[model samples]
Target chain A: MDKNMVTNARELTNTEFFYGHKACAGCGGSLAVRLALKVLGQNSFVSLPPNCMSAVGFLFPQISFVTNAIIAPFAANAAVLSGIEAGAKALGLKDHHVVGFAGDGGTADIGIQALSGAIDRGDRIIYICYDNEAYMNTGIQQSGLTPYGARTTTSPAGKNLPGSIKMKKNMFEIVAAHGISYAATASIGYPEDYLKKVSKAAQCESTSYIHVMAPCCTGWGFPGERTIEIAKEAVDCGLWFLAEYENEKFTLNRKPSSFSPVKEYLMKQGRFRHLGDDDISIIERHRDHKWEKMLKNWDS
Target chain B: MDRPKVVKYKEPERAEDYPVGATFKAGHLVQTNSGWRTFRPIIDQDKCIKCLRCFLVCPDGAIDKSGESLEIDYDFCKGCGVCAHECKVGAIRMVKEGADEDGR
Candidate 1:
């Protein structure tokens, strides 16, 4: 809902895009979608697929979307958005925006092919992948988007295998490789940067891919309000980086002042409740690898 | 991999400026139809006891007191429905959409 703390303009404003729906007390996905829609405004059409979003927003007359939202299948968010963009043109509609909001399970895993296709086609639509690690919607199962060594229903904590075995997919690089006009990574913690990137993408005439690292309080077993705090922790720990690529040039938007220890961040969440020194060390090594890569890119 | 054909850019001609309307030129396509949703909260005045819970809890300055009636901007409402939730008397309900169907 218009979370723009600075604005008081009131004229048919929708504060909550998808309200009256069921979500945990502190649902980062809900907040991320709402904030992204606010930035896009009334002229935008959101294409959501089957996930927590679709389930929460598109359940019959109980729709939470306050504007011109269209429900697509779980995997068709990108393609549907492309069609909406085309339809917008054919109908002489200007000042309209299209957004494909998908979960990381949908974007980094099941729906990646369609997303890649839309970017490859250079369709002028904005796509935001709300990365909450595991697929919290479908029983908190592990998906390709889940980070390494993070507990999930599928990847239960054990002596040998604490959580997920593989690291999270490098989605920003993958989308950037498509040579799209705009690609960015953001987190809920950085509102200005996130809003700025969304505004920038809206003004562009080519496809823009935005990956937002949204923390899941229910999935992570943290307090509802702590969603934002966890989001900040992820960024502070260097486990998450906010950056954008314009014309293939990488720009690091927010770099960590001093890297925060990953253990403390993990300890606060229930999903990481099983983590010990070995798992902590593994997570640290992974974070260092990502940080070094980002540093190298920034320097280059 | 086949390198998809990239269309060449051409300068858009300035059409006779109108107050507000859609225009198109050769090789230019306008995005007309947006499939996204915008949410607004409507109050059941009968149920509304002027509790003003919505006005105080609104994160986006979309809510205001209009005389005895509470005024909410459907256009600017992100549809978060915090106002509806905060209403003590079950006064506010989130409406399906803002504006009309014609894209006015």
Candidate 2:
């Protein structure tokens, strides 16, 4: 009933999302889908938009899911999931978990309207945005979610200009502003913590939104094997922070004893390789400033 | 000039499929396969602590428990090595696809 909450051991039962599809060998978004489905289980129905995940994870003659799933429009993932939740209720269904699983581009940029509407209307769904920095599915295009100083095909670093001049959009705060029952920032590196949060969201009455940092090896120009490693490093260096909001309360899940240098995090990805000392200092200051702001908002 | 003949056939007399309107099937499997992997994961029973982390972390969802052991479905595993990479006990090893008889 409660997805058989695993206590001391990881359950041996199979998950809803399985292999067979055409995700890249080192794809992080696919990995995130697998973990999310593991917690949501077969009773959940996920909405995949026109992201890298929809392209590789689900397509024509071949599909990867073992449970129920639907492919939605790029900007209509949240909209479609809202309808599914409404329909599920109308059918006198019980225990149906409708989830909108979209990419950074879909969630923060294209699909924000439907996402915001669904959250505002208080739909019972868990909207998770697996952010891989850029629109990686379409040949590394720059999206609003792409972090500053990162290179995308649309915002390539050239002679005079550095990569993305604008900083990343803060969507978690935006979701929290909606007075959502559950909103959090999670990373692929923290599976236990991430799973716990998703499960908690499942039990909540209001909509839940989790923005997860999913490192992309191909888009980030790193070896596929370093996907989780980079995700962990991002949080360790304060490049990304893990925190949650419930009932208007805030708590930081991770606050490193001593923050790792931002250079270690930036240097690992080719997207930020062209950054010089001045750019690095700017990024370092940005991270510290963001962390200070989060500290102030902590416990609010 | 030979033109194909349009023969009247039985209209496939079955409930052709509509997701919602009034006809909808509750559940079905969507597991298509592409296991073109050169290497596959093999969990050694001796070393496994039954932590189930491999099954939990496999991107392909190819790992399953067999009795007190775990197994990987090479037919669907894409050789991502994520299971092996995440295994803390080193119980899972990625072996060459055809190395079963080579005794490596």
Candidate 3:
């Protein structure tokens, strides 16, 4: 069982990420930052790259972080985090969590080399990718992590093709390949779970990675209000999977008794709205197969 | 839009007063812009059960829960109506940001 931040009775958490930062209305990435910081707290430091998070939240003088945060290049967050960890050790600093919070593009594509190198070098860092599916801050261009059949500015739907036919790069599994201490998939809708994951990851003897599914209102073409709603729907419909790899063991969390159909999740977003019944069914098939593979990995 | 206040850094003792960016824009960020929002959610205390549902689902962290009843900080709220939408009991409603009396 996971430890709860639950004090006494009410499920409230003191946060290190504050408002007044320039995140869009109902931004899931913003919430992810808040929850992650809620666990990591004032002792934590964030090394952000040139993603939406760095662009808006920490807009120079008008910053929003309640903890120490620094900006790194798109491909160098992991490298920077490695240095921070080394420096902390050299100075004999304890309980300081150096986090590399990047977007999907930064993690799965541009920054993969540094991330793999850091993992291989056994850096004690908490690396989190708050994935909103595409390069949102740069105007919604589809990246390697964008799911199949979702439309982006680069992968606009046309008569020939529905949208992006590329399957999202499996970042969670790939990070696990390096044989790190911990890695997991989490979503903004599941705040306590994400918070608990961060809390646990902070105590890891080695690198910890969390790939958070953050819904983008503007990019996904959903109402700003539905950011949390669609996030929950993503998990409820099995489009997004939550599980962890800790102590060299795979454990899945919160499986629905009956997954609401893939359509129930897809139809909510305009990007996936272009998807037809055929596309949804095909996606559903993939989802089921992915869940099966995850179960197999867990039982192994 | 007004820029954030930049605080001058002093020695170790005063350094604690200034955080990461050393900007004093903490709580004053909500309604600083002229064209920030078109709608805002108003809580109906009569129907509220204090479930903290609205408080939890607020993406911007705009809802203030310090008081006995839940209140919204107009400055931080972007009038997203997410709180209104997420209220399971329909205890919140989205009011037009400017249609009625000038929303402070």
Candidate 4:
């Protein structure tokens, strides 16, 4: 549904958040951090868990950060951000924005408890989950966020339950249920909507949670160039919706009048290559059910 | 000692502009037209057991081995540490530009 919304590489913020650091070609995690940090500027402190990000930047005194950065334990990002927020307020420096960036593994599974506590307690901070659909930091292992029928190291396609059997946990809805001020699903495919949600989250008075779908080129087994394309097609096919929830009201940002088949989105990545006719039918049924439910809220 | 086998990027039958025996040093970094470039992930042959884990795990096909020693082509290697993580024998070490974590 996103039409002509991608940003040219030139218009992006030139900050060196991950400069001189190592990431795979077309690494969406890298781009997500770069752009997200650009919106949440130098005054922000990043509480990163032990994910791909910790390995992407330089270590210790030779760090690659232009802003204050802290590495929390694998699942303790939210707790650390809570502490930072409390500490900053105690020091009369509450203006400091504490941004908690966690991968899908950390967010949906390991760090979910802490994230829920922070939001429920009304900690003034923004939490961003750069979901790549698997535990890529730990050699492509399956996580709670892995989509059904996607291949991961633990969920390899084979005789029984060919790929990941369980559908991805509906994290946006889960976060919304906590009564946060803002909750949204975003994708790197739609830069303007992505940036707009990020910018709005930055200014919100209460806790904000933004879950972004960042395409992983190496783990997804796709060419580096298709990163943006695949992300765009996801929204087009309605597999991933770009919508926001504020104060119990759901607003579908880009509601498609008519969406393409989910197969168009799935077939682009090798992770979904093993899906058969029945699997595709099941996915369509699931997608239609979810989309219809979401549409009901915005329909009248 | 294998003397860290030297390789020259030459055409099949023509002499390339690159100098022979120039030796890609361990810590040297160059600023190309696009951006500043640097050396990363130096391999210690003594520790290398030729397990081929580095080759198999390289995100980019930047690693090329001749069955005996592994060579890293920095042109395509973005320096992500999938190889170093997969290297169980502790043969590959990520040596940043002008830093001494080698013996650490």
The top-ranked prediction according to DockQ is 3
Residues forming the 10-long window of minimal summed lDDT in candidate 3 chain A:
A7-16
lDDT of 4 at B27: 14
lDDT, candidate 3, at A63: 66
DockQ of each: 0.03, 0.20, 0.28, 0.03
Please provide, for model 3 over A86-131, each residue's C-alpha lDDT reduced to its tens digit, 9 standing for 90 to 100. 9889999997889989999999999999999999998999999999
Looking at candidate 3 chain B, the ten consecutive residues that score lowest on lDDT are B25-34
- How displaced is residue A131 in candidate 4, in Å? 0.5
lDDT of 1 at B50: 72
Q: Model 3 Cα displacement at A27 (Å)? A: 0.8
Clashes per model (N, Cα, C within 3 A) = 43, 0, 3, 0
Instruction: List, residue by residue over B75-97, the lDDT tens digit for candidate 4.
Output: 44565554665577888877765
lDDT for every model?
0.72, 0.77, 0.79, 0.73
True-vs-predicted CA distance for residue A120, candidate 4, Å: 0.8
Q: Could you tell me which 10 consecutive residues in candidate 1 chain A have the lowest summed lDDT?
A: A4-13
Chain B TM-score (each prediction, in order): 0.54, 0.62, 0.64, 0.56
Tens-digit lDDT track of model 4 for A1-300: 233222332333433343433566657776677677766777888888988876765442234445777788887889999899888888898556789889998999999999999999888889999999998877899999888899998988987785999888999999998889998889877765777787778777778999998889889988664676777788899889998989787788888898888887888889998899899888888889988998887532
Native contacts conserved, per model: 0.00, 0.31, 0.32, 0.01
* Chain A vs. native, model 2, TM-score: 0.95
Best by lDDT: 3
